[model samples]
Target: MKKTGLTIAAALAGALLGSPALAQKTVLTVGMQSTDAGVLDPHLNSGTPGKAMLQWMFNGLVRIKPGELSPEFMEPDLAESWTSSTDSKEWTFKLRQGVQCHHGYGEFTSEDAVYSLARAASKETSAFSSDYAAFDKVEAPDKYTVKITLKQAIPSLLGIVMNYHGGNMVCKKAAEELGKEGFAKKPVGTGPFMFQEYVPQQYAKLVANPNYFRGKPKLTEILYRFIPSDSSRDLAFQSGEIDMMLGRQEQAWVDRMNALPGVKVVAMGPAEMSMLHLNMSQPPLDNLKVRQAIAYAVDRNAIWQFRGKNISRPAVSVVPSGYLGTDEKAPLYPFDLAKSKALLAEAGFPNGVTIKAINTTLPSMLSFTEATQALLKRAGITLEIQPVEHATFHQQIRQDLSQVVHFQAARFPIADVYLSQFFHSRAIVKTPTAVTNFSHCKVADAEIDAARSETDKAKQLALWKTAQEKIIKEVCAIPVNEMMQLWAYKDSLDLGYDLKASLNLGPPVLETTRFTK
Candidate 1:
């Protein structure tokens, strides 16, 4: 259901790669693997690195400038202030004056905000449109204030706003002028960096927004290089060709980087979760007993050892360990091969069943799939892992091509957003209105919906707890690992904020980042 907005001409424009800087200007170059920048339209998703890089060029009305110690805090961004109705159905925003878009896109106004939200709330352009399902209408009282009325009171309304959490707040005038193809090539936003040049599969360059509302960025330029090979990225870092990088996931790689002088290896916690989802519509796995067998068969400690204990821990909740409703010690189905085989026999598959799964060929992902294949073999299950290119894997999974889809993703703040996006019947795949419910498991619909409606924080979390417990009790999915992320950088720069963890898995390089030398 994803669309590519890049025109042939725009793609050709992106093909002409640029050389790295010859001088030591105030610039930071980040290296990564894979070059699918998605649509580059904020309305559409541009994978993880694209969104992290976009943070330099875009702002929501309010933003999460997470603290060095406490990242959950929210702060004001484009919208200086606002108020909500007593019932939280009607909300109003007071826009800040003197903010400018990157291009000659004219000063941003309520009209732009109105257009952005309506587009984000529509499924034609957005994957998380259901996240904004509560919005009834958006109205602009004047140039400085915008009001949004909700269809129903949503407990996580603040999390749904298009402007917060590194999501996009696009300008209407710029988008219409360029059209989708042109806009994808040359996006205009109100952030510290502006689009300078883009060369697909090679590099994207951004220059500081001089007239930024928050003041000009300290780093004059950001140069992003696409180095798809893991060994190539490490060699680039070691040879002083790149400034920073998100390194490989195994601990041996982290230890190697740590041994090098002037290289900083940071492990950022409360990060992404890696889960093995069972396609309930698929054969054999459709039986609850068979699904439970897969859960009981997993030895989480073995996975921790294979992946690295320093980077991961056994996951107990569909929610991450630090969050509410998470229990690390007493998972409903703890590791027990005997129980796994027992369930398999009860389901009439005593000799076990053959299951086919697919995943991207990223080293970390393939590593987990290999480990799973080995362990499941001991439990009398045959697993065939089909390796596909990153883009094809994402596309094929939605088509229900695999019974097991193992995916890794960054964290979301609210439990309701995570559960609903992955579990709700309305979010199930293959339907015309499909979202992210890949498993097609539907035991906790009542609780998931109730959690969204509950206004009280404590009460709302209890509902989410019930829903998470159901995922385990019924063996809908197996929570393989929940772990922090590791990234390495040359010791020549000072990243102003804490990189302990980011909403997006990349480092927070912004106005505060600059070279120490």
Candidate 2:
């Protein structure tokens, strides 16, 4: 027998209009490891909860297809259509009609779009300020059209920039009325869900928007719970305390969950890169030879096996695989101890070297830190790993506190976004304009700039590859592995999409997500 694509609405119709199998779903509670939502201001909320919340609470001018990570899958979102000038410096977007702002903020228009971009480009508020350094100005033509003029052309604007959180629309009147503190506590946007309550380090609750333009959300309510401990979260999932649990990076954990009755675990692909971040401004690590030694010391393959061969693959480039221009054959450290020790000796550390770095509670970071610590020890390098609270760890890392940083993140679904945010000199940490440049190692800045400016896709990709090759060649930091994201949920749950891969690891429980009959 063939199984039909059973939509929630169809299932409900069959129940009342035909026959009943199980009750319809209206709410779902998901357990995650993030401690808090941080700042819920769309520009500042770079954390997992904040990112997921932003998607639910706001709509971008342009958006990637739901549950799709590829750049080719982008579609019209807030802006129904848009056009660019010949030079690609100026872009005009025609705003969609009747898109009301969440909670009577007034109908969304070009004004909100301009305001949000202006705010995002503000140094005081936005982490993405550096990414938009090329912006000249934004204008609202009449009330339904927005014109963004960039000082320099950015080739990746359409595929990435417009769809990101920084570009997501926010009602000008509502945001200004609430102010920074008020806005963080309660945000208003034009999405299917509306903010209900935020409990800080515990849970953030959101209710379905009745007046949503795309029709009301299927789930009446969605609650996000913060559970930092891996074991505790797994236990909660087993006990059915949480409807969904974020899976650990380890294979054994996922296998155990899969073995459980009435439980299903999904390993989502092209997750993100887990990199061995080296602070170029810091001591022995400041030496390129030392950085190369560190890279050659660790075994990316073995470390990946610790998680599972099926769930992860060795990172070949800083941008990682799956994104366009990410070469599968990109160069990497071959895990040679003798060569690493030789490089260390050449870098003025003959016998051994000790490096201090902090680790987060997140399984990805902790696992990388611990696994690499042993490998480095074997190569006569001692790595002191200090575990820090996730929030504190983020603050300290940006302040240039650690010599090495083992971080995992899916920055964006494009090559430019990842390269610019992580490698660009303007994005250096602790400076007035700071983003996520953990290593503070400048590699091919001019090349990256040229790539962004290049209108031709082939040339842009070539320049991006050139920049990444320079990074790998300079041994700025070690590219460890790109891990898989696993989510454990009840068997009855039926997410509308095929769950192939997600741009972000969050389960796509949109208006279509429900339970099967």
Candidate 3:
């Protein structure tokens, strides 16, 4: 009797362990390269890591189709349907009824949409206010309808309104009640995840939203860990402490991670174009010959090789290659050390030129800047790099503290957006309407303005090409290589969709994501 009872007990224990409920994974931990988020408010935060966290906690009226990067694949999210005027100056969006906000924040309505749009367009609130400069007004006609009037028709109204940058919506009532500071710390939105807690320089904890519009998420919770160090983050992922991590943008790192058992490395687009913007307002760079010399010193092919062919490609124009209206034939300065030296001599710098820059300490950015430094040294140009924390680097550079600014960014995949932000006079840094014109480049302003309202597709493309030609001729900025997004995850984790590209610049963890084991 004792032997039989023991045998039954052992069998029961094994059965309990093998049950479906006990075998499923309930939590997922993601490691990102950031010390901590400056804020959680969708309209205010601009850091890549902050954007990744916001993706889980918020939803825009329209969103890029999951696992896709282009605006052409955008589909309705909070808004059920939308219509625009023939001129494309006016747009009306119909909000989905019965969509509930996280944490009992009440249902989403047109009021929230209007409030969020106005907030994002305000320079006092959003970092991307320039993107909405064409907006005349945003109003709610009814409880479920939102109307927007633009001063001028853009290439795609949906590009600015989709779930990216300033487009992510927030709970109107929650924002009003919590105020700016409180709401940033504890945001309320309508998505699969809800903010639970945030520890500075540590981690952010989010819980599954049971009242999610689509459905309850399979995972019980998500812990977004802040592991800035590459080696530490990689070790955590290898030790099974983190389910996913942002991988280094190097071929060696990708090869090493891919070889690991049960580890999957993802390299996808659309890539960020890394460009070196010489501040023309600054003394040394103000000289045209000096600017041209710096351009001749950079080797685009060398940079692309350093980051591997799978993850990077040489940039062909001022605007990223693959963007709409980009002219592949746009003139580029070839890498000629002798030409660089001659130009420096003609500029009255017979010995060498020393250019100062405030650069980011982030491994990915620092590595690129250091490589440029080595290349410039060979051409008798000294690149003085002062490395600071990532956040500080962005702050100081925008304040016009850097003589040379190496900015890497992926915009709305449109020539107008890139040209206007980087070369138009209105966006010159330190000015009231400044966006990111670090070079203080105004040569392409005419072509950029013409292209914005051009109704004809061919005419618009021609205008954009002219703008690129002007920017390149003046040597306003040297186009470097484009670096694709890279990340690694465990093979057992099912992301529920093909991992192609994400505008959020990180892996998308949806409600359907789960562990197969």
Candidate 4:
């Protein structure tokens, strides 16, 4: 049993629709498609984007500065600055004032922070509780002070705080007021917006929080419509039915939108890594030489060219370019079919190998995988692609049964968590561990442990570099490319995000405000 905090409390019921009170607010309609329905409980949601929405509906004690890169230790969202001991085992945070919860829970106190952190660490809670796995206990030293005791000296403790779903602060009174059942359906938190209602596979609505810590949001309300298909998404944009579309659509349609009287596109490509995950536990890939051969076979440049000029960048390592201090000079596994062939022969697969690749059906993503299929074929490898919907594709990865899978990993400021989650064998043991290392490469255990133990800042970076080298040397997976996400909306609509940091459109709907014409 994974001990994730408030997982049950976060379990959401079907969306509340069309109540007269819900209809009274101004609704700003947006578009989305169907996804694996997520529980509203903050800890239960999966990624950063989910955390972004939760940031609005519920606030944590500490939060990152809007539009800033990772240098964790949450600044005040509900709480002010925190001080940790030099040994890094103990931490004390002071709470902020005048904060109010959606259900009329009064000013926040040290007790709420203690309750929230303690709940997250409770083994009886849920799968997300392990996010607080390092914390031994959380205590309220005073009305405004929270003291936390840790299991070890982890340098990125604050980064852990900002770890999307881990730290959403809930009002204890609100839970008691609504009771378990009602609280699950209508949870309360301290944020800039409050959840209004959700119409499954249709739409979700939110109204501005009058008691928002900053000022109330300019947009009276936000309406998120679940319009899944790209064609339908394009149509919604064309007919003036939506203000923004999340993922990529037909390039022709995007061009049309740009040519339209009032539309613009913002293309952002961060150093985020998207790659093919090869399960080393499976045959064919069970041999390291075979994995290395696959890495050498693919022409990443050709993949980008397939979609036309500069849409995506070919990645040589698991660590994508542009993260803080990531040395680009680090060796890249370049495309060399000859070397790939040689490696395959050394592995005793001179005739090449036939393997199945689980790929997503998303149009933009399909292009890269198709190019992969073509390039691998030339290296004498036969890639039989298994095309499935994105949701199902992810579910399959979770099963750890696929020999090879094509997927995208969106992570942030620190490389540590990114390395730990994907490369660490203990993290992925597939038996209810703290994190899911989907690759199932149990062979990388020593390197993973070394990286985790390193706390000295400079030495940690060096250790991480060594770990990357080792993983590459052994051929963990063929890292493909970093996606360049593009977004287009009415020229007059200021989405209010710094393009450099706005990598994906999944969870964070931070500064989205509809302009008043």
Highest lDDT model number: 3
Local distance difference test scores for all models: 0.77, 0.80, 0.89, 0.65
Candidate 2 yields a Cα-based lDDT of: 0.80
lDDT of 2 by residue, 432-491 (tens): 888878888687798888887887888888998888889888877788888877888888
Worst 10 residues of 4 by lDDT: 9-18
| Candidate 4 lDDT tens digits, 252-353 | 544666677777665554434567878788888888888889988978787655653544666756667665424355566888999999999999999999
Write the residue-wise lDDT of candidate 1 on 1-517 in tens digits: 5536667656555554432343344878888766555456766653565766776788887766643322246667778887999988999989898789887777888888888788677777666677787788999899978899998787666565634332468888998788878887888888888999988878999998888887888889888998768999999999888889877888899899999999999888546778888999988889988888888888888898888888878776876676543444435677889998888889998898889898887777878888988988888888899998666777788787889989776545566766777778887877665666789878999998887777887888778888888877877788888667778987778888766766656776677678876
Among all candidates shown, the one with the greatest TM-score: 3
Position 320, candidate 1: lDDT: 65
**Backbone clashes in model 2, listed as residue pairs:** none
Clashes by residue pair, model 1 = 14-200, 60-163
C-alpha root-mean-square deviation, candidate 2: 6.3
Model 2 clash count equals: 0
Q: What is the TM-score of each candidate against the true structure?
A: 0.91, 0.92, 0.96, 0.83
* Steric overlap count per candidate: 2, 0, 0, 11
Better of 2 and 3 by lDDT: 3
lDDT of 3 by residue, 1-517 (tens): 4568889999889888987667788799999987877688888777778887889988988998888887788899999899999998999999999999888889999999999988888877777788888899999999999999999988857877888878888888998999989998998889899999999889999999998888999999999999989999999999999999888889899999999999888997779888999998887899999999998999988998987887899999999988899998789999999999999999999899999989988799889999999999988899999998877887898899999988988888888888988899988888877788999999988888888888999999999999999999898999998998899999999999999988888887899989887
lDDT of 2 at 70: 74
